[model samples]
Target: MSGQIKYQWRITKYNPDYRDENGYYTLKEEWTCPSEIGKIIDGKEFTLEEYLDIEAKYIDTLIAFIIESGLNTLRILQLSEQKISTEDRSSVLYETEFDELILEEDKIVTLNDIVIISKMILRNFVHCQLYLKDRFFAHFGWDYYMYIGSSEKSLSAITIATERGLFVEEIDSSPYYFLEEDTTRLVQWSKKENELGMNEGDEELLEFPLEELRLIFNLSSQHPVVGNIKIKIEYKDFFQRYLNHKMDFDKYEYFFWGGY
Candidate 1:
């Protein structure tokens, strides 16, 4: 119950006076009226439970429907057809968001109905550019969040390796594998691909090997100055090598990183 909860919507337009142990009055799905700060919903307020009810039951549905229907975030939020019952709380995406997506359902749609209906949209499908930290960032699409939950002990080990300085020097004594510390990357250059091994496949997203995923670490924690490094293998060549050795981190390093 206490790990990262996956959420795609950004909360805005809520009251600031209310505070939680986690430091917010409550989460709203979209822009709220500034005057509605005391309330959980943007234009109006509801109890925390009310908000949770909206999220647990309808949030995923909203994402699913919008992606399936190719609609805007606000349009999906406000759609009257999405409501299941009167008892269900109203949506902030509906209450405040103010526009529609002028889409004819793009011609190049993936043919998988189940996946189209089930998956949340990760990458932006439209053309866009952003300026962050003095650089121009451009992207036509973005990726869905990757969840790689591991055993606590394995995660602890990974965390340590990510922090280790000159970990490349410790390959011989390393328990799982060696981590390389590389120079910090530019923020604008990092968003073009999935930070974790590029989606497995555009359709199913079969998980990528950790070795491929691990190479992108520096892109994620860039400003923090954490350890990330170049694996010295071309991205095009990674999968061929990965499939040859069964894709386990074990000895893959003994073979790949250390080149032993």
Candidate 2:
């Protein structure tokens, strides 16, 4: 019978080491360690059979966990053969530690569970300011108003939408969709000439506050709606429309930037 094979799985910490004169690590501002260079924070050897089982089940979920946990990268190695691999080692192997994947009660949570947890948190609680880039079109002489809700207000709106079996995209094309920093968003739009069919007297415009439009997306984590929320303005006094809708000024405020 052949000897048992094993594998070493490690997570590299992104600690930049930029030394000055004597090879001592310098200020954090100066450090820009290469992606390949990092100290292994946690790891252990697993039998080949054990590793195979993990690869079959937790590999993808574990990778998602690593990214969500703010880890730099994962490294996997064949201990028996002394082979090293990084990045997309699918042709060779893949990575994330089993230890770090565990949740309370030793319950292992999938990427979806993590997303639900985040939405639940934002739904019940809130932070002061959530800065977001506004991307929409407005015509001159048209009135506009924003639904400047707190993160909590956004969550409540999202929860209502979710219960109605609706995704934010179905509710509004450019609804308040907040994406993670690393996530890339590709948006495309097509317009037919005269589709708007604007009449001469249609100069006045009013933007309704669909509180249900705030849906956060993190496709990386497998959560379409992760829960962060934004909106627009024409005249300053028009903000009273939002307050008239029962929005609490003490907890939220209307804010925006840029003009066309």
lDDT of each: 0.25, 0.25
**Distance from true position, residue 243, model 2, in Å?**
23
Model 1 agreement with the true structure over 100-201: per-residue lDDT tens digits: 222211112222421222122221122211111111111112211111111111333333323331011111121211123322221111222445433232
Mark the 10 consecutive residues where model 2 has the least summed lDDT.
136-145
Model 2, span 163-194: residue lDDT tens: 43322211221123223332322111112243
lDDT of 2 at 6: 16
Write out the backbone clash pairs for model 1. Answer: 13-32, 15-37, 32-42, 123-142, 124-142
For every candidate, C-alpha RMSD to the true structure in Å = 19.9, 22.6
Residue 223 lDDT in model 1? 18
